[model samples]
Target: MANRHGPCMEKKCSWCCDPVKVPANFSDEKIPLDKEGKRIWRDREEIVVPESQMETVRLKTFDCDLLDTQTGKCSDYENRPEICRNTSCVDEKSTKSVDEQHRETLEEELIPLKGKK
Candidate 1:
């Protein structure tokens, strides 16, 4: 089975493909602020697929605008956004621990989008 980071080296798997949902605050659009002017993050739900079932399950929730469904690849891999560059599908306990730290780092990189819609 491919790690949760993504597909194995040679073969291409649709593990990270179209219709996958992401946090609404993932974009550069302005995040709504609450009454106290606190950033209101989207109520993003995490999909925790068990490592054993990663390959067998058909994910139909990928919402990434950059995915190329025809080729089963990212349209702009070289210049893909930071979030895309950092994500993986490899599933291991040790990797998960590392990924957790990495996720925190990514979250820190987010600059709240200013200006209202």
Candidate 2:
């Protein structure tokens, strides 16, 4: 639960290790980042066509880890994929709203699970 603008040590994924890119994680599609470290994902939006491999790839969540422990160092550091190695996250930015979002998402999901209709 690190502030998007806080120090790296202060901010970390709550679900996984630190951001670690291995050889396999690298990809030609380099993720662009803003000065504050926010990723520019707009370019791919237009390119993801319907029922294409790229479209399928788009469905895959790139969120590395939700915890601090699983980010900087790869879980499979020795055998990570190139695409994973090249993946990047907005570390410098304060995706701080995450906490709020997480809570809201969970609440929404739970409502469905509770069969409260």
Candidate 3:
């Protein structure tokens, strides 16, 4: 996962810790459930990538246990996983504002709608 977008330099950034897409074989039981016992992943299906090896799509995400919601920082920054060390929020999408992101998403959705007869 070469981050051509560069390293994550934003202060108080918890985007990486928010939701991680796991393998398709990952157990649903491991996913955290809300108080209503509903699956916690609100939008896991938004992004699905094809895994040729497994011949399936990987499209599930969950909050990392190490994330401190109040502070939006990792509990153990020094001992974070290698994946974390390699992650950065300098990408185009991560740099956009919430409203910009929403607009982009709506525009993306409308593309298919416009294509439809």
Looking at model 2, residue 8 earns an lDDT score of 26
TM-score of each: 0.37, 0.21, 0.40
The 10-residue segment with the lowest total lDDT in model 3:
108-117
| Model 1 CA lDDT for position 4 | 46
Name model 1 segments beyond 4 Å from true.
1-10, 23-62, 91-117
Tens digit of lDDT per residue, candidate 1, span 12-78?
4334343343443354343334457654333323333323344333211234555576886666555
Candidates 1 and 3 compared: the better one by lDDT is 3
| RMSD (Å) of each candidate, 1 decimal | 13.8, 13.5, 10.5
> Which lDDT value does model 2 have at 99?
49
Find the candidate with the highest lDDT and give its number.
3
Summed backbone clashes in each candidate are 17, 34, 0
Per-residue error (Å), model 2, residue 112:
12
Which predicted model would earn the best TM-score? 3
Which runs in model 2 stand beyond 4 Å of their true positions?
1-58, 61-74, 91-117
